[model samples]
Target chain A: MANYLKLYPIPEDYRFHRGGQISQGLLAYETWGTLNEDQSNALLILTGLSADSHAARHGEHDTAGWWDYMIGPGKAIDTDQWFVICASSLGSCKGSTGPCSPNPKTGQPYRFDFPDLCLEDIANTSVLLCQSLGIEQLQAVIGPSMGGMSALALILNHKNYTRHLVHIASGMASPPFSTAIRSLQREAILKDENFNQGYYSATNWPEEGMKFARKIGMLSYRSAKEWNDRFPRSLKKVPQHPFGIEFPVESYLEHHANQFIHKFDPISYLYLSRAMDWFNGHQYGTPRGANPLNDISLHSALVVGAETDLLFPVDLQRELHHLLLDSGVDSELIVTDSIQGHDAFLVDQQTFSQLVGDYLSASAV
Target chain B: MANYLKLYPIPEDYRFHRGGQISQGLLAYETWGTLNEDQSNALLILTGLSADSHAARHGEHDTAGWWDYMIGPGKAIDTDQWFVICASSLGSCKGSTGPCSPNPKTGQPYRFDFPDLCLEDIANTSVLLCQSLGIEQLQAVIGPSMGGMSALALILNHKNYTRHLVHIASGMASPPFSTAIRSLQREAILKDENFNQGYYSATNWPEEGMKFARKIGMLSYRSAKEWNDRFPRSLKKVPQHPFGIEFPVESYLEHHANQFIHKFDPISYLYLSRAMDWFNGHQYGTPRGANPLNDISLHSALVVGAETDLLFPVDLQRELHHLLLDSGVDSELIVTDSIQGHDAFLVDQQTFSQLVGDYLSASAV
Candidate 1:
């Protein structure tokens, strides 16, 4: 099980884009394995859009982590050999200071008043977490998907504490395709009459809107081939289900929507997707003025991509590799053939695990 | 506009699966260019899902037909030389007898009473159309997407009709991916609260449901990359638009849906999608079963695929080519590199027109 501890900063002037301010704030994080003397073997993992710090462990049920395959003993990440830490990013819902978190002034959930956050804020808070844990430096930093973007921000914007980087299915900045999908998903949520301008009452959450948004997202997360193979034209025996959707695929979508609503916060999804859309290297003070490939120092990096990933696509990976090579960085690119698409990193565990293991063992960290 | 006159005693009876009978229906068709005395210069063009018999013409408005680029004079199909005829398929919303047509027996629209159609019905009707025009054989039958499927069916079931075939972004039969997408679109309509269970009154149609269905179809019709390029994340400076969607892409979808609802029939969409799913060579009494290559006499065929076509990937085209070769059919396979996805046949008109033109001219009846 993964647990969180909140660290509050001293009162300081914090201004927000939406004409709001927070005097002080609490940051939430979780840790795994054990910190050794000298604190140089720590590895930090950032999470994706709806994920929390509970990346690798189930609570009291003795269940596995969201990324259990990569963090077990003798695994790719090797939890037993190195101390690992993951944090519930700011503006997120899981044990973090976000829209669902209680406001210090009002004693109620911030909701709409939650300030906008960027990757730099996340990286800065992570640095605080490391300092609080008495760690002076990190051996490596790794993340997947959006988490990978966060890791890149930490490596590029923050000091060179991390000696090695492993970013999978991420890019230097948000591509137009990602922005378009996010924009549509956001529209799906906001256009719902039930959204009520993002001020829904506690009892009447916009479940339908959130489900529609998730359905749109599910389209991008998996390959068309996988969908075809898993749920064919075969209709349910009943022909006409109570929901009026006859095909098994519609039922599968409904099931997927329900699960997402149960596990994720609608507001968090909105904020994270927006943050991803707003991600620009130039905004974070990149020397090349937003050209991601032009302004990064990578001592050693491994970039992995999924061949069937329509969302990220292999072209993005190839672009990232070319950028790294042009920047005179020692970077390796690997493409994994999987029908899982964007979710291949999570679903195709064996191949991903082996790829990460081989890359880490071979790299000079 | 190329108008179709209703003719009685359509050469054959359309045998439906549900034991319903539609007897003696006539399909009006138009031909371009000159057919030689031996009737060897005939080229049969198949209509798409909702297209009409007016495939191409030199109309006063200069609006052109749906496939004018491929069938006009000096264009592909070469109106200057080959006699090209495009006929509306049976059970289509456009000019064809469909669910919206009035039932002589009940003095009302067929609606739910319309017979469930199969691919054979479409092919058989096409054969009837050909016979009415005094044509016993075709130089080639060319179609794109659904039209492509119909072309393959024509040669497989009616061996004496088409000697050459060209199928673009189509398959031997509908794959599970196509079926699943169509099923989802169907479910979107059927699940609409106002659907009236496919029994809407003549005056009160479920336009919202139909629009949603079209929106879903549009999503699959184009590639994600194309969408990204076309609709970047540019916020409208003035947010006071009556339409609530903020993003241009969202607005585009709304507009597309509304236009489709105005011109397309909901019942016809459902029927056509179902017919596509039910396409099987075995069901049509073909010797080699549903596999197009297994039991058909294909003299020379040209198969074209769009590089970004998600509905029918290039790999599927390759599979068809391999199958044809293995079955001793002379097949020429060419993949069109376009970002238009399944709709590439329409967008990449110049290249496709040339391909179809060369293929049709080289294969003389």
Candidate 2:
């Protein structure tokens, strides 16, 4: 299993405006494959909501990232050929400096007092992670969903570091659907009696609230047609469970909610979900004043979307692709015909693998 | 204002396998305009989730149904020539027998004790209302979303009553997306501390749960792209809002949630959402087994879908139309381009009105 080691006192002053502030922090990350001597064969992957740095093959038994389908050796990302690194994002719970982490000043969970994070904070932390690993340039920075947002931020904010950017099922900024979903999730947490206005004790946590939040998210991650086809009102002869959720679809959601409650931290889920809602291209300064895309020179950019992805639809991906093309950047837009919805980038391995493999191979030259 | 003289009681003999029993009840509904002496100029309008018999005309002001655009004097249903009757379903809050209604025997709210209601219950109640009103038959039965399901049920269960069926942004039964979304809404209600396992006190009811439930419904009711287009990370001028929700979309949801909490009954919302999840054609003893269309006998059927409807997509509606045609039934399908999404049936009146007018006029001869 991958282990964690924390470096004391980050030298950089961390600035935030969401009430609580952290002067310094450490990052927890994991790596796969091996770095080449030239350090040019490196790829940094970003994670979506409720994900970790376990990008690929964290354990001897072949434990990989949430997107293990696209990141393994001989897989789409082909870790055997290129070194891959992933880090738990800021404001996330997976061994990262987040709301559940001990506050540097108080030595207690930051709780609601944790500073609100933007895509910039996530990109800044990833930059530090790259520096800590002694890597000056990344061959490609790739991410899906919120990770996609972070990847865009990385390329736009630190143009010199990321040569190629691959953002799948994401947007240039936080869209209304993302914000609406996040708002509901946050409200679910805030309204929980045990939440105590984000000050709940460790023992009596808001498990139900977290479950509800996950259920809400599960709806957005998949498409309606897929659900209609997968679990069409056929009453499976399985005896009615005690949960009153008799349908296969209901059972699926229940299972997902239960799994999320067990694996995810309630506070961290809230903070990260909110972080995704806060992502905006305008945060780098007004687009009216500065041409951020014009400033960033990318060797190549690949934007991929799933046909049924209701969260970041193909239209939004097209918007991003058009923006890159308008900026005179080399870019290719591909829409994956998958019913897996927004999670298609992770679930539809064969299609996603082809896209990623082709993009990586083309960008490498 | 429409008022009922006597509230019908659920019969005590009825029993449900889901550990609850629904009392058999009757609904009193009224109509506007004149029913031609031939009784062929009557239109039956079904209500959406949490809607009431007040489908149109709130007062003598001649207000229209929730679908004012398609149900007015010169519009689709053509109230100028057709008598329109909108009835509240049996298990509803607005002057209908529901979980919130007092049990005749126990003299207390039914709570979880309310019997599980299938689509048949709504159709059955509507049939009885039609019979009491002395309408021999309906020229057309129309509804949107859940109302669409009810309309389908009316045609399938009461074949001879309705000559034409118009279902918009809905299908024969509840799809997995509906089940998943409804389950989340149910979870929201169940997780509320004040819910008291559906026996919540009348004073401090589960308002937060209702808000959360409404928010979940709202997400499915609109398209993700529409949300992005309408509320693109543009910060609202409102100063009191926090970071993650500083966008207009967040504010829109907050306002929507608050409105839902104030106007909608929490227990009723849970009941309706659950009923929608439990809707299955197989449960109703339909002769065609899993496929309700095989047994449906209608003079004509018109199915409409909103281009951006995420909950009930155009493809689903198309499938239903195909099924109707495959079953040798006369059917027409139309896709309305509307940013309002699933709620487009209520919002995009002009387009839908024209479609309905053309279809109804063609069927009249």
Candidate 3:
């Protein structure tokens, strides 16, 4: 890996789906390992809701990767054997051109002026990032949750852009329930006084609203079975604040929500959540009942799902797998029994690794 | 049936389990139909989470009931043949003596000064109400959700209080996940600026926070199958506000939350939800592997549950049924296949009514 963080410019006349354009924009990205001389061993990794491009340990300290369990020297998607690139999704606050980014024309932050984004723009931006690095995809693209939606958009639209796709716990589009929950989260932020109609300065954050949204998001990410198994109904032996955490699960949600508020931007979350809701493979001219993989038969894909995931049901993954097979594409579905729900991809790393690793290595041949 | 909403006095020394006691308190109740000559055919009806004593209509109008589907002349628990009583739980805001009720000594609302209540208190208060009505034994005690908890408490403590028991979509104790979600809801309310340590004026509600809690509660009450089935990912043709709803499911939750806020009292909700968490049937001298129905061998019980319920899994209801049978009680269990989750007891009225009605009539004969 040559650089820990890299920035690239977008076209001056670039426009997004919802009628707004940034004359000039910069996207921040991070990469690991070396691209082969022929530029044929590059793997692209897309992220979930609020992660940045730092996908693994950067320097001396054992800094954890979001997917650190599955990506190292001899790990599942071995960084030693394959060059991996991760770009911050467009409209994210993590060193990317977003609502928080300064406007080139007005010499101030875009704030509420940022364009309404869609799933396609996120997919296209990642493609543009790969092109800027002079890399024609050879290895694969891996994504989970919203990232999987991006992977679906990328491969289904670009066809031969990648050789393999690893979609975990995601579907072609956000279903009604998922979209509705996200809408509630956005409403929480919008209704917050500190949000100030997305005009709050860098120091004045919508902390309360973002924290509220994260609490809801955490519950949706995991299963009730898992929570019941992990926590108990008894109150804590020792109390902290006046309003004590009577149950362990409540404490768990509170801790995660607090941690998330420190990192995620309310505006970025609003845009990204909406983008996820708007995703659908059928919308891209691949009519209903037809496979998104029908036009790209050469790409072999691995779809992994958790049986306990209420958000993205295992049946949807099975549906996609069969659709790909019927279209003559080499596709396999792995439905694992896990209480971790949609989060099984991250928690049950060993199983996810073995299935994804074997498929990636086999397809690389 | 006498008074539509009658208030009863509690003894000054009536202390709850958690040591806080109102020197003097009142409980409000309502009833329907005539008690049989011997008062042996009186049916006691308990409610779910936050319902009042009005289980059905009181007058000659098409005025609806929450359980309006299954309780009427020639209906499930046919009011024509039996008397029915619905009492507001001890901590409810509807007509019950709750936190909002004035402190007899201080002439002010109890607020946080109210006792830390338990399911037992709620159950015992109903018994006191019955004693006041000159009823000794009941034909049946039917309850759903939290009401089921109260029924369990009543039968376990007062073994011969009822001739029959009907428990629906509830268990002996609140599971860890349900308690955790409830604890979070409490936190959301308390953390609100308007909540003011549960001292807010009745007119000035913690509207936003309570609405947020209700949204979370509604999601927990129903299953993912119901949500996805009820709504689709289509935005309205004409948008109303900047952040218009992208799915009908959002509108449904918003509407429900609005409705709930208007009727429910937040302070009472806090006490009742906590009381639900503290409910553990085994703690009341019923040891492990010991059925609460042990001494009531003459009582026949019906335990009904929903296969899709993530909150109160059907296995708990099945375990209780088996426990009753082991105690030489004529008990039966009904597990309905429905996507409505714990709410199946409310939605699938025909199935529920037929099963309950058959058992009651057979036991009567």
What tens digits encode model 3's per-residue C-alpha lDDT throughout B135-177?
8999999999999989988887677899899999998787776
Clashing residue pairs, candidate 3? none
Model 1, position B138: C-alpha lDDT score: 81
Q: 1 or 2, which is superior by lDDT?
A: 2
TM-score of 3: 0.93
At residue A50, give the lDDT of candidate 3: 83
lDDT of 1 by residue, B1-365 (tens): 53433332554456664457764344556667777788877888886787877777655465578887777666767777887777677777666677767776787767777777766677777777767667888878887788877776777678768888888988766665566567657756765556676677547777766776777677678887787678754454344532245556666777888898758777777888877766654344345344446657768889999888888788778877887787677899999888898998888888888887788767764
- Model 1 scores a TM of 0.88
Fnat scores for every prediction: 0.21, 0.86, 0.46
Error of 2 at A224 (Å): 2.2
**Candidate 2: pairs in clash:** A55-A65, B11-B24, B22-B115, B55-B65, B56-B65
Model 2, position A360, has a per-residue lDDT of: 95
Which candidate number maximizes TM-score? 3
Task: Give the DockQ (2 decimals) of all models.
Answer: 0.31, 0.62, 0.53
True-structure RMSD, every candidate: 3.8, 3.2, 2.7
Between candidates 2 and 3, name the one with more favorable TM-score: 3
